[model samples]
Target: MKLVLVRHGETASNVRMVLDSLPPGPPLTDLGHEQANVLADALADEPVVAVCASTAVRAQQTAAPVAARHGMAVRVVEGVQEIFCGDLEGRSDREAYGVFVKTASEWADGRLDLTLPGGENGRQVVDRCLAAIERITEGVTGGTVVLVSHGGAIRLAGQALAPNVTASLAAGGLLPNTGRVVLERDGAGWRCTAWSGVDIVVD
Candidate 1:
């Protein structure tokens, strides 16, 4: 199975750099909508059979035009939402973002046991995201499936599921709005083929 995990488009919270992880979150800005349409156009040639999205309104909004282009509805699946910010929810200060980045770095460094302060652990985040993917791919035997999700969750899940996802790539930075992390799942395991448009070379 081929999975394309896409980060949701920009929102006011994204521009403000706030940790808005909860559901029904901010809608996309005009630029974000344009980005989504561009994303749809970009994938027009792919064998896209289904589209899925997290519960976030931004994600659903991003998936809408893509699914519409494919003549399908966006499947809102559970467990693929953004990394919960918990106590840091809605915070935009540097300190808050600093803590989030530190925790993300720890996860990328293989510290899956460490919990984000007042938030989920790396293991929890990865597990749920993987489960969501499994659910989305169930009964699907072929073509590409797009999972519209958040940056933090996609990074964690990609790092956890793909052996080709290097620590540097996993920890590098937040995926830009509508950015994609493409993976292929086979009998062996999952392997990342691309991250944010850069192809991943297997070691």
Candidate 2:
């Protein structure tokens, strides 16, 4: 099985650098909708078998074009949304940057219990993402699938699953809007073949 993990397109909050992580989060910015179309175009030639999106509105919006192209309904999976920002939610983007880097570093250092004052720790967020992906992939035996998610959560989960290549990237949260990572299952295990292939190289 192959999994195409895609970060959702940009949102209104993204432009202003605000930390909006919960439900009914702002809709896709105009550019965000354009980015979503680009995502669909990028995967136009792949043998996509299923489509999944985080419960967040942004993710669902990102998955719309791709799901419609494949004629498959978007599967809104639980536990795969962005990490809750806690007290950081609704704060200015400039203010959230430091905490974002700090908490991410803590997670990389194996301090998964650390989180912002009101947010979820790395362990909680990564565990949910992993479980959500597992549930979706378990039923898939072949072909590619797409799971639209947030940048922070995807990289965190990537680090958890593929620490060697992802560690350095995870330390800084390198995924951009609509960034993509490809993972393939070989026998009984899974491995990342391409990570943020739009720019970053894995080999």
Candidate 3:
């Protein structure tokens, strides 16, 4: 089975770099809507059987066009939403971003104990995301699944679930709006084949 985990399109909060990870987050900006349309077009050739999104409004909106293109409904899957910002909920300052980056980087390096103040630990975030993906895969086999999720949760889960993923690749770069991380799974386990368009080196 293959999983195409996608980051939702841009939002007003994204433009301002605010840490808006809560549910019912802001809707897509004009450019975001265009990006979603482009994403839908890009995946037109894929054998997309199921389209899932987090509880967030932005994620659902981003999945709408893709699901419509495949003649499927966007399944609202829990546990795949953004990492809660906690203390840095709405701040866009360098300090806030620094804390976020440091904590997420630690998680990528296998330091699951480290956590953002008032936010979830790496273990909690990764576990839930992985479980959600597991649930999706149980129902769909040998087919492509599209999951619209947030950048933080996507990166964390990608690194944790895919042994081929390097800490640098997982934490070094940003997952732009509508970016994708592709994964493949078999009896052996799950492997990350691509990150944001860059092909990963499977070990």
Alpha-carbon TM-score of each model against the true structure = 0.96, 0.93, 0.97
The ten-residue window of minimal lDDT in model 3 covers 185-194
- After aligning candidate 3 to the native by TM-score, how far in Å is the CA of 48 from where it should be? 0.8
Q: Which residues of candidate 2, in runs, are more than 4 Å off?
A: 198-203
Q: Which scores higher on lDDT, 1 or 3?
A: 3
Tell me, by TM-score, which candidate is best: 3
Candidate 3 or 2, higher lDDT:
3
Question: Tens digits of per-residue lDDT for model 1 on 28-141?
Answer: 999999999999998888899899999999999999999999899999999999988888999999999899998999899999888767888889999999999988888878
Global lDDT scores for all candidate models = 0.90, 0.85, 0.92
The best-first sequence of candidates by lDDT reads 3, 1, 2
On TM-score, who's better, 1 or 3? 3
Estimate, for each residue in 114-168, the C-alpha lDDT of model 2 and write its tens digit: 9777889999998999988889898788899899998888888877776344566
Steric clash pairs (candidate 3):
none
TM-score for candidate 2: 0.93
Model 3, global lDDT: 0.92
